[model samples]
Target chain A: MASVVGEEVSNKQVIFKDYFTGFPKESDMYLTTSTIKLKVPEGSNGVLLKNLYLSCDPVMRILMQRVVPKGFSNYTPGSPINGYGVAKVLDSGHPDFKAGDLVWGSARWEEYSLITATEGLRKITHSDVPLSYYTGLLGMPGMTAYAGFHEVCSPKKGEYVFVSAASGAVGQLVGQFAKLLGCYVVGSAGSKEKVDLLKNKFGFDDAFNYKEEHDLDAALKRYFPEGIDIYFENVGGETLDAVLLNMRDHGRIAVCGMISQYNLDQPEGVKNLMCLIYKRIHMTGFTVRDYYHLYPKFLDTVLPYIKEGKIAYVEDIAEGPESGPAALVGLFSGRNIGKQVVVIARE
Target chain B: MASVVGEEVSNKQVIFKDYFTGFPKESDMYLTTSTIKLKVPEGSNGVLLKNLYLSCDPVMRILMQRVVPKGFSNYTPGSPINGYGVAKVLDSGHPDFKAGDLVWGSARWEEYSLITATEGLRKITHSDVPLSYYTGLLGMPGMTAYAGFHEVCSPKKGEYVFVSAASGAVGQLVGQFAKLLGCYVVGSAGSKEKVDLLKNKFGFDDAFNYKEEHDLDAALKRYFPEGIDIYFENVGGETLDAVLLNMRDHGRIAVCGMISQYNLDQPEGVKNLMCLIYKRIHMTGFTVRDYYHLYPKFLDTVLPYIKEGKIAYVEDIAEGPESGPAALVGLFSGRNIGKQVVVIARE
Candidate 1:
């Protein structure tokens, strides 16, 4: 077997075949090998990176489809699909980076990339934990759960918390964090396995498989008779409307994502927003990147809990880059039990 | 006909007509003229009030419709409508209130009302300002705009502010307050007169009549090519959808009311909520009842501005109780230019 080394070498890259119309299929991406000189070009400020592991997020599904007003740049047809990933430095002309250093941040989904190391990249120093942990529990997903719960929800002790998509990367941490804060947490997942994991592994107060429930409103009422105080919203549409009816006075909703509505031609209408007026609820949507400055503080808070076994994390790692297409597509179908991570190589 | 001086006597009162359907027409209400004795019952702990001024708010329109699962009480048929109003104390058994004292808070729309001197009501000490002002500017509407802008929106100097329903009670004050904070303020109103008031009276940097605009998104883009930093939302539906497209990164929206959707069978679905995820925007809905504790602080902040004529106020006062039905109904149709008040009698 040939290995990639310091030479004028060829790097295999994955590129989007064309703009996806609906749900992204495996055929939409094709891997192509190309050669490039290993030396950094003169007067250029870019870093040559050898990609290790790439994070497959549900949001990437929306980025593949056509959305109006062009929110974030969608994957360009016949070009590299960019996302967050971990990489090793190969060659550097940027002032902040050097060769052989490990870094984890936003990068393109390819075997190798020459990136400008803009505001997105951060050098990974501590390897006490698996580097893959940054892709799931300690990176964007972790910060998302942390900031949405602490900053947006502003939860108090003994509050009743409800999480949707409860077994995913962010929802799992949100449930655990709420439990640590002395809250009574209930979560909803798609499958029985995920529901059991919520109750047994993550130590949620209660959990249910939303697929089995005939009426979501009744399910929510059964779980929260007194009504929910904080709702960590990941799935929008009917679930949001049902939760709106079940929210207690002064309830707060931290909207992290709306996975259910992302791929639809038209999103579902919410009929119960008038509840916000009578109940005086606060519904806020936030992105994890806005809270990056709190990364060190988040590590200080979550790491101790992790070491003491007070916090538990789960991941569904796909073995190789060839399976990346399947792993990313599985997110829309709720196939991954926890965080969906694509493993390129074992270090 | 003679005026009854501070004499203790039984008086006729009006009661709410049943829950309304579709648009609330005048016939939905009934002035029953039932008599309530001007005296607190023996061993009772409530105050008997002479209702002077009644506020007609948009929320009352929602209460008149059918109830949902998270339902609240609607006005019973053959009964009077209820809302926040100003009244004079006729008799009192509650220790916190005294006879002949002035008070302002949530009260029923009637000639006489017996209310418990609970936490919702406040004894009015400063009566030098027009007593009717409590029905609009210095009352629940005032506190709503104050808290929604200062607390929720968190405006900073030089930020661009956009207020919908800008000449209505809350939006008018929000635009002025944003301007006073050194923000560049723009407003959308239904009528040209309101647009003029927004720019001239409220000191808004720019104003537009949304009714005249062919496209709401284009109107927003024309007024704010760089995008709005803060949006004080009153009319929801398309306005909210348009504002979402024109929001700058990290914009804040204070959702005080959604008058446009109150009468609709099903509220319009918002398509651009995903913008919040990408732009890191914050949208929060609040009620004045949650922020009444800031009344004294509000008085401190607003009184000086009012005295110095730095803050301008407009009112649409109806002469008698007969006009109350039309005045309240007019809010939905955008007939009233400013605060809508129904005056039963002048003190």
Candidate 2:
């Protein structure tokens, strides 16, 4: 690879158009080509990255709304969206990185990105596994499942565990982790195929298609006759309310994301919070930012499972920059079967 | 003081009429006269009690409803209601009690009756403190505040603590406990008089009348500019919804009882639960039943505060057994200022 420093290259990018109410649609974003200098500027801790694989996550919709969390910088209307991705460093002024080092963390939805905030970026150490694992099972989502389940949920062996959005990025790993711990794990997902994946591929004790259930409370009761001891919450609103009613005494709910409420003008009211007190349930909300300090420890534990064929990962990849917008939109509609991803470039 | 254990006495009782929806009313229960032998049954673990003071609690309304918890028996339509009371034991079949023992725990809302469940009962140790305090500050409500705040909320020194229904038996004590622990304590009550008590009497840093606030969220923001660190959630529904919006990151909520939701046919949906995730909050629910094991520890801590004139206790006593129904009903409408106690006999 010859030095392409200061060379202007055509950067194909997925651009957020504007924040809109209701469920996100494909037209909310557009793909465009622009020129970018493939070099880090002088006297700056910045890394210029060639974005390889971009992730389509539920949080994308949360950032798309007019109301983002305090101090969180959402996507700028004209600029390319920032998300988790596997990138190859083309040039670097940061002491932590150099040219040809593979990394994963926060990156823009563009062919080439000048990443000023290099704090979130981690250098990819192991390459024996598929590089795409850095986008899902080994990245933010993996850390989320690890921290939320082991730390927040405080799961024990033989305890009954329930997971919502069970076939999605964070949910799949959580169910598997719970099962691997000798817990009786049950998961609820959108479609029949995803439910099948949860039961057959993920080794969950049972899994149900939430979309087909008329009575969520009854559905939960049927799966968890003894009541749920741990709940990994992703889908919120009705599912959360139903889960509350079925939680056993001293249950723990780890709130990762609420995909069901993200698109609504007004999120649904949770009526079953009274259950929190009656059951002495501890409902905790957390993010990967708080737990990333344990990344090294997380890798040490999860890698052996990956090597021994103990941990299974599923990814729904949409090839090319053109498919990015639709891939992101499909999350709200439950169109993606597993961890949704978009490939800007394979290598 | 001669034994009159075998004598039949007229037992004036407050009988629950029937289960009804919406807010409880005085008409829902009626005063009636019945007869009972003033002695424990032969070989049975029963305590014959002369009920002195009956507590008017919000949970009374809960038991009056048809939707009681599993294995929990609700108030029978024609039976004298069971509640917390300070009583003089006339006779005992259990080894824990003897004749002339002053005790507090579960008692029927009647002048003289036989109590079968003695597990919740405790022999009142200090006769110097008002026996009525056992029905309020020294008994269930006092234990409730102690456990919910110190144990459930996990309060740290200098943390911002907010108490809803701040002048009530539990809330007043919680606010005072937080202040005594070097925390910035604020409380919201239903009346201006109650608000005054929270500040001047209970030693809260500040107090507000929640009834006057048109926007509960703005009201909380005005009081807690830094945002609430621990919320003593007594009034649920809208107050809880507003508190959720104003909570600081990593806030803890201790749910003691949701007084606001108990009266409603349908509980208000808490819409701001998304805050639970955004702020990494821990919302926990608890009951006095599970925490009563720490009763001895609680009495040790709270008694010194009472002896030093440090923990101020205020009780609103309704004279005579006839006032029982009205005093209990007053809780829903915020008609009672402090701990509502109905006295059958002062001594």
The candidate that wins on TM-score is 2
Return the number of clashes found in candidate 1: 8
* Candidate 2 Cα deviation (angstroms), residue B317: 0.2
Give Cα distance to truth, residue B224, candidate 1, Å: 1.6
lDDT for each candidate structure: 0.84, 0.91
Instruction: Determine the backbone clash count of candidate 2.
Output: 0
How well is each residue in A250-273 modelled by candidate 2, as lDDT tens digits?
Answer: 999999999899988888999988
Q: Find the candidate with the highest lDDT and give its number.
A: 2
Docking class of 2: high
Residues B1-347 of candidate 2 have per-residue lDDT tens digits of: 34388898888999999999998889999999989998787888988988899998888888998778653679999988888999998999988899889999998899987888788789998889999999999999999999999999999999999999999989999998999999999999988899889889999999999889999999999999999999999989999999999999999999888998987777889888889888999999898888898999999999999999999999999998899888999999998989999998877
Chain A TM-score values for every predicted structure, listed in order: 0.96, 0.97
**What would the per-residue lDDT of candidate 1 be over residues B195-230, giving only the tens digit for each residue?**
888888889999999989989999999999899999
